[model samples]
Target: MTASIIEHQDLGTGTEEPVATAAPDLARPLIPNPQSSIPLSTTPQDHHIARMAAVALGLTLIENAIPTPLPGVKPGLANIVTLIVLTRYGWRVAAWVSLLRVLAGSLLFGSFLTPGFFLSLAGAVCSLVVLAFAQHLPTRWFGAVSHSIYAAFAHITGQMLVVYLWLIPHAGITYLIPIFATAALIFGTVNGLIAARFMNSKNEMLIHENNERHEIG
Candidate 1:
């Protein structure tokens, strides 16, 4: 997602400060920090992270089950979890979940440490990097949809670079760019919309729970 930099006047300082305003609906408060009573060895946060990773792995497995007409053209269903975690938890959690998904998913598929694993790893790292920067942008201008598109293109770009440098050196490989780009665009937008719906649903649930608690009190 692209962010629009807003210039804010600092009356006290008599200077303009650039404010990055995320869309009110899209931007959420950070998850509350875990309690100090929780031991460092095993914490509630770890369980939450594990759950996120498990969901992502489940999605990866489902995608793996489907047969694709074109190679490397999967819908990337696993990324939905990454998007959700990134938006709700933070980049660190999102990165950990994504890397765990790639590692565990590759192992389950019996492609651990192989070219496929590396390819997946490369794409994930690239996508995470793009997301890291994109998250800083104004949410109104760069919400989940734009973030997905950005990550999609970054993933393809990273894989293509790897293919050219290590797997296939031939210039003919460049011909595949358009096909990959087209797929990325379609899948990215679809994934973003789905994630957005999920996010909204979750947000509503949270709001309802809070209201119920307030009324009970």
Candidate 2:
């Protein structure tokens, strides 16, 4: 007699349903994607502008922190970066950086849309306009030092105009020009020297790198 052969699955009751297999996990991890390889979309010029703006803003904050003997007697260190950008890049690039610094600095310092911000904006705009003309002057005769002094004067003039027109209308404010001029002269010279030194060093470094590449090739 032949033994009855039956499949294991066939032994199950007809009412029993087949078990479904679990699908593979397609969900991403909850951890942050710190290792993402995507690069920033900003170009080199954008990066340069951003870096300059940041440096200028930082200088602005530092100037704000320093105690001043007078209301408008800060060192204006931020102008150094602006001068550097103007000489190295151009008036347009410098303008962008300067305006960005004013806006970002005002926002960072919690002075946005205030009288202080208006003054800063006016000063920056005037300085940029002056620099646009100044940059066209002979580089040999009008260097960073000259540009700095001119821009400093322009800045102060712009601020004074804004103050006189909007903040405080007073003819006596013109008397303060000598003091502001003195401060601008001193600070502009110092800032110009610093910017010149930095630009010189940067140029040297670039030259060295280029020489190395040439020799390598």
lDDT of 2 by residue, 2-57 (tens): 01111112221222333232243347332235366433333346556777888899
Candidate 1 TM-score over all chains jointly: 0.75
Error of 2 at 66 (Å): 1.4
State the RMSD for candidate 2. 19.9
Tell me the spans in candidate 1 whose CA falls farther than 4 Å from its real position: 1-40, 202-217
lDDT (C-alpha) at residue 94 in model 2:
90
Candidate 1 worst ten-residue window by lDDT = 1-10
Positional deviation of residue 103's Cα in model 1 after best superposition, in angstroms: 0.5
